[model samples]
Target: MSKKILITDDALFMRVTLKNILVANGYEVVGEATNGQEAVDKYDAHQPDLVLMDITMPIMDGITATRTIKGKHPAANVVMCTAMGQKNMVIEAIQAGAKDFIVKPFQPERVLESIKKLIG
Candidate 1:
């Protein structure tokens, strides 16, 4: 079976871009969240194999959500999405229990690579 994924980003365009890439690659996108709090809720609801989370979001930030999810579910797999100049936040995301990261203006290969490496 194809692995399930949850995509969380404040920008609708980003989420759509990620969904397009993932779906084309045969990864099943189970849910989408517009903010960190929603991401956490969706994570609990879906129990997806992986999460692609954006770092700077309203309501809550991705790093904090990753920390919350990992705190409750140590095995939860999270991959942070960061833009240029968000290097420090990416590091923070990793420390907070993200499995890996993908930089925005993402390459489809990188997204697939991280998900495959983490879950497959």
Candidate 2:
């Protein structure tokens, strides 16, 4: 079965773009969120196979949400999405239990590779 994924980004365009990539690559987008808090809520509700989360967002940041979710579900698979030049935040995110990360200006191949690496 296709892996279920939850995509969280502050920008609607980013979410749409990521969704398109996942759908085209044979994955199912179970839900979407515009911020970290919503990501956590949707995560709990959907219990998706993986979460593609942005590092910066309103309400809460991805690192905090990642930590919260992992605290509750140690097996949760979270991949942080960041822009270039946010290495420190990316490190923090990984420490918060993110499995991996994808830098923005999204690349379909890299996204798929990351997802496959995690889900497979």
Candidate 3:
């Protein structure tokens, strides 16, 4: 079966772009969130196999969201979305239990590769 994934990003464009990438590659886009809090809610609601989360958002940030999800479901797989030069935040997210991360201006290949590596 195709892996189920949740996508979380504040930008509608980014979400749409990622949804297209994941769907075209055969991964199920189980849900989408515009912020970290929503991501957490959707995570619980959908129980997706993996999450693609943005680092910066209006509500809770991705690192906090990652931590929240991981705290509840220790096995939850979260992939943080980072902007260029946010190395420190990326490290924090990793410490919070994120599986991996994709830099913004996302490359479709890398996104799929990260998800595949984490869930497959």
Candidate 4:
């Protein structure tokens, strides 16, 4: 069966782009969240195999959401997808239980590579 994925980003464009990429690559997109809070909530509803999360969002940031999800579901897989590439941010995301970090404006291959490593 195709793996289910949840995409979380405040930007509609980012969500759309990610959805397209995942769908075209034979993965299922189970949910989309406009913010971190929604991401956490949808995760419970969807029980996706992975979450593509963005940092620097209104409401709650991706790191916090990742941490929350990890706390609740220790086996949850989260990958940070953001424009922020700072060392500190990457470290924080890793500490928050993100399995991988991909800087925004990313190549489709890079995104798929990360997801594949986790769920494929």
Candidate 5:
């Protein structure tokens, strides 16, 4: 069976782009969340194999969401996606238990590489 994935981003365009990429690569997108809180909720409902999360979202940020999800499900697989490639953010994300990080305006290959490394 195809691996289930949950996508979380505030921007509609980003979510669509990610969905297209993931779908084309044969990953099943089980849920999409517009913010970190929604991502948390969807994660519980879907229990997806992976979560693609964005930072700087309203309601909650990706780092907080990743931390929350990881706190609840220790084995949950989360990858941080954001335009901010700042050192602090990356460090915080990794400390929050994100398995990998992908910067925005990403290459499809890079995204796939990160996902494949974690889930495949």
Candidate 6:
């Protein structure tokens, strides 16, 4: 079965792009969120196999959401999405229990590789 994935990004374009990439690569996008709080709620609702979460967002940030999700589901697979130069936040995201990260302007191959590494 295709792995179910949740995508979270404040930008609609980013979410669409990532969804396209995941869908094309044989992953199922189960849910999407524009902020970290919604990401967490969706995560709980869907219990997807993976989450691709943007580091910066309104309402809540990725690191906090990652931490919250990890606290509840220690085995949750999360991959942080970050823009160029957010090194500190990236590191914090890893510490918060994200399994890996993908930098934006996403390359489709990279996105697939990250998801495959975690879910496959």
Candidate 2 backbone collisions, by pair: none
In each prediction, how many residue pairs overlap at the backbone (N, C-alpha, C within less than 3 A)? 0, 0, 0, 0, 0, 0
Pairs that clash in candidate 1: none
lDDT, candidate 4, 1-120, per-residue tens: 999999999999999999998999999999999899999999999999999999889999999999999999999999998685466887899999999988888689999999999999
CA deviation > 4 Å runs, candidate 3: none
* Candidate 6 residue lDDT tens string, 1-120: 889999999999999999998888888999999999999999999999999999999999999999999998999999999999999999999999998999999999898889889999
Candidate 1, number of clashes: 0
Candidate 1 vs candidate 3, lDDT winner:
1
- Indicate the TM-score of model 2: 0.98
TM-score of 6: 0.98
Kindly indicate the candidate among 1 and 5 with the higher lDDT: 1
Candidate 5 residue 89 Cα shift, in angstroms, is 0.8
How many clashes would you count in candidate 2?
A: 0
Task: Give the CA lDDT, 0 to 100, for residue 48 in model 6.
Answer: 96
Task: State the C-alpha lDDT per candidate.
Answer: 0.94, 0.96, 0.94, 0.93, 0.94, 0.95
Displacement of the residue 2 alpha carbon in candidate 3, Å:
1.7
The Cα RMSD of model 6 versus the native structure comes to 0.6
- The list of candidate 2 runs beyond 4 A from truth reads none
RMSD of each: 0.6, 0.6, 0.7, 0.9, 0.8, 0.6
Worst 10 residues of 3 by lDDT: 111-120
Compose the digit string of candidate 3's lDDT tens values, residues 20-98.
9998989999999999999999999999999999999988999999999999999999999999999999999999999
| Prediction 1 TM-score vs. true | 0.98
Query: Lowest lDDT 10-mer window, candidate 2?
Result: 111-120
In the range 1-120, model 1's lDDT, one tens digit per residue, is 999999999999999999999999889999999999999999999999999999999999999999999988999999999998998898899999998999989999898889889998
